[model samples]
Target: MSEHHTLYAAFAERIDAVLSALELEGALPPGTSRANVSVEPPRDPSHGDLATNAAMVLAKPAATNPRSLAEKIVEHLSRDPLIESAQIAGPGFINLRLARSTWTDELAAIAALGGDYGKSAMGEGRRVNIEYVSANPTGPMHMGHCRGAVVGDALASLLEFAGHAVTREYYVNDAGGQVDTLARSVHLRYREALGEDVGAIPDGFYPGAYLVPVGEAAAQEFGDRYRSAPEAEWLPVFRAFAVERMMAIIRADLQLLGIAHDVFSSEAALQAAGKPEAAEAWLRAHDLVYDGVLEAPKGKEPPDDWEATELPLFRSTRFGDDQDRPIRKSDGKWTYFGADLAYHMQKAESADELIDIWGADHAGTVKRIKAAVAALSEGQGEPIPFDVKLVQMVQLLRNGEPAKMSKRSGNFVTIADMVDEVGKDVVRFSMLTRKPEAQMDFDFAKVVEESKDNPVFYVQYAHARIRSILRKGADENFAPSAEHLGLLGEDDLALVKRAAQFPREVEMAARTREPHRIAFYLADLAAELHAFWNLGNADQQKRFIVAQDANLSGARLFLAAQIGQVIRNGLALLGVEAVEEL
Candidate 1:
């Protein structure tokens, strides 16, 4: 095991020993496991440094006052060489103050590990699949899809960094009603381009001018032959042409934001092209396929002509869904869920874990989809691990006023449009500064501002400042020899200590499947370095790369260089850029 892991284990053992002693003395309840006990720094540095709730949890069961139990635990804990003091605080919490040497050791560990300081083995080589930006091929991707794309991409990067085998996937919704609308839109444009006055787009048909070029392409390829062709004669050609074009555009937009998928599973191919009869075979084998009539959905109704007809149903309710869902519509065509089920089943062939990133609007659809996968994997060894994360909407603003809907797109703001306004680095980092489930506001005016509130600029400035110091040190013949690292002073040691926590942050984010932790960690580390720098400004002797003291200056420069490496590594996991001299 790594030294950091060993240190944590030792710390955990000490806590367990204290818990055991309390139990043996009849000071606490039996069967209380110390495995969940945690030792972390207190929010207030003056409140005895580190605190634990162990005594508070054991008080009532031990028939003793919490503070009394805390006092006993502290008496037992103060013997450790690493701890300088221990005390009982408010509500019987045990607070600990570690000797300064402990923090100094942490700094040394950071220097030793360099960029690999925070790596963890929590994942144990498990495989995970992350699917995101599964937008339909009907049009260009908009701002609504941007947040999820960034979140999913960064999350996948975080997972991989934490040692999980991750596959990034994009589900293409090309076989459904939406794509048909796109095809029809392109057909109209095609006819329009062929000198036919198609007039304004027909009702139920897409009217966006984006399709005009698609229509023109078709006209140039077929030479007006499709103008008078039957709907069936040209529908396939139109559908193929439009979906391919739309996917191309979507790919370009994702690239603009620095995202690329490892797999692009096409719904159309899953349905009719590859592995024909796959969905039907799996459904029948599981007894999930049946003929039944669904109750008319409440608060909504299909056309009056929509009659209750016997159609294939999937017994989704068996797995906690509210209602059994339809696999085939009344028209004998596969429902969207049918295609989705087949796609997930295909996923099982290559992955052991599956995660889908969706919009909050799909909250109502989570259960049935999970149920289908559960049923498919029922008796085939272990159940496949499936999870869905919903990315909430993004509200944009400029100059404290809500930005008008994207002016050029004439619809929702496109991801490409946002990338054009602000570079990809700012967009990626700012979007991930908050949890994916929380609604976030991205202010165009503030992200580029040169202040602490703008994390992108703050982090980049820290890196640039570090570079300047190193260059100055090099020019003055202050060589950063490994010998200097041992003499790191308090402020320099504290900065390295903070930088060493990057691996831990990566592990936490990946194990919880939350990438926002990386953004928060980088910001906090930057703040720590900035604080250390400000302190130096007041004390000329302590300034980084002090020209008169070569040994001390070289050691501090090494610490700062390590800090820059950590910042770059952390930002890279979030898919954000790290500039050396911004």
Candidate 2:
């Protein structure tokens, strides 16, 4: 109830009370701000339970000695009921130890909350749009897009769990040059399907045979209708057919990984009929549209046909970007950036906060999107903010060798192939085991290896062991008694302490917009659970399913059940299956 009031909160509240009492909210000492206060568990448990640097931050501003100010703050915090003691430590840092019963009460609260132990209301129902895995409509999703897909889906789930109203979106680049190439490739396959001698695909076109079915379907649907038609006469029909089929394939691939988008915004539809002038109008209204000639190439000479011309540009540099970006080409064709600006503008109308999940190749594009948002919200009292997260590449390896790329998918590993080789649970969990910003190596052999080194299996095994303990307890007629909890020992206390920290961890991960934090936390929690179980192996009295002592077994069984439930809930949010019988 009321978020269970984490023990660290009291330490933070005490620091805030001291600041308020001193009336020092304006600014802060050099290189630090008064609002930079943070209370976290000490890295070294020997130091203390929690540590803070409020005194160090306020030292110069308050014109007091660092250690002396820390001593005063320690004294003020020692008066709190939750704190057992507060000590002034290294360089004016205050380390606090909480009463043992505080953790005991936290365990009881976690048991009461059950599956909802770590749920928070921090989001306050704010709407957040998460656009991710908007892969090109040319083919199925590959391994490169897997990590971002998992991260975006898990982050969206984490936000929802933390009380945010989130919209999951997928942007389709159907109107781009790639999709146009897709149409021509399908036409080649269409002729082959019609029994024509279209041997091997020529260079500069898609050589993947995955489009064979698409071509066959088109030929069957419109027999001889577009066989002799000009490219212009059939481009529209073929492009629509090819894109729709590719999208179906992509959707199926996402389904294999348990990901679904709430909306699939198309670049074609954004400017299809009457929306082309919309983006230009908005740009002109914001004065971001300008006609300028870009400098010619420095390292290599341009083609003889290349000519200098003035083009419309968006002043992205005003929003902390490196330089201005072009919105249109000299041939009067809208560049990719122009379509993206319109897409984001359309997204802002529906959601106040917009977040894009893109590959590292789009790192240079981040500033322009932010600049467009600022320009669009220039005069409005309420402005919509956008954030773009660039996910680095994932190199898939197997048996210490680079995995062979499938030519059917055009030099990439499809998500379907990945999930088929590795189960959905392993693929989803392993992908998110690290931060999305970090470049990850997905070693197929190690992921399937059954050991602690494999986080997915380790966590699943922990849940399975918990279930086995409960089943054994049931066979021994061990049901938790109200009076049995008094038997909780030192090992039990340690387990409960880690369990009680779940809510605080969830809040931190959600606030930081990082779902990998959950993955890492679950790994730690699993280790603690496994360690606690191994302790039982060395000592008969510590066993959770003691045949001789039903009362002791009852208390331990309840704790084990609680652990299994928490692990299940957390893994579910990450889109990883939690098996009770693995």
Which one wins on TM-score? 2
Segments of candidate 2 deviating more than 4 angstroms: 1-7, 10-34, 58-80, 273-276, 300-303, 320-322, 407-410, 480-483
User: Which pairs clash (backbone N, Cα, C closer than 3 Å) in model 1?
Assistant: 118-503
Candidate 2 lDDT by residue in tens digits, 1-582? 345555566557777876665555433333445677778888887786788988887888768877987876776687888788899887898888877777667666767777677888888888999999999988888988898899999999999888789999999999878888889999888888888888779887888768989999999999978876899988888999999999999999999999999999888989775454687777787778877876665558887876788888888878887777888777777789888887877788777688888899888878877888767655444778778888989988998789988767768888888898989999999988888889888988999999998998999999998988877777767875435677788788778767766778888888888988988988999999999889889988888877798788887887787777778778978998788687
Residue 221's lDDT within candidate 2 is: 92
TM-score for candidate 2:
0.91
Q: lDDT per prediction?
A: 0.81, 0.82
Error of 1 at 79 (Å): 5.4
Off by over 4 Å in 1: 1-10, 13-33, 48-105, 108-112, 191-203, 216-227, 273-289, 299-306, 404-408, 479-490
In angstroms, the error of model 1 at 469 is 2.6
For residues 439-513, what per-residue lDDT tens digits would candidate 1 score against the true structure? Answer: 888899998999998988898888888888888888888866556566777667667557656766776788788
RMSD of 1: 3.7
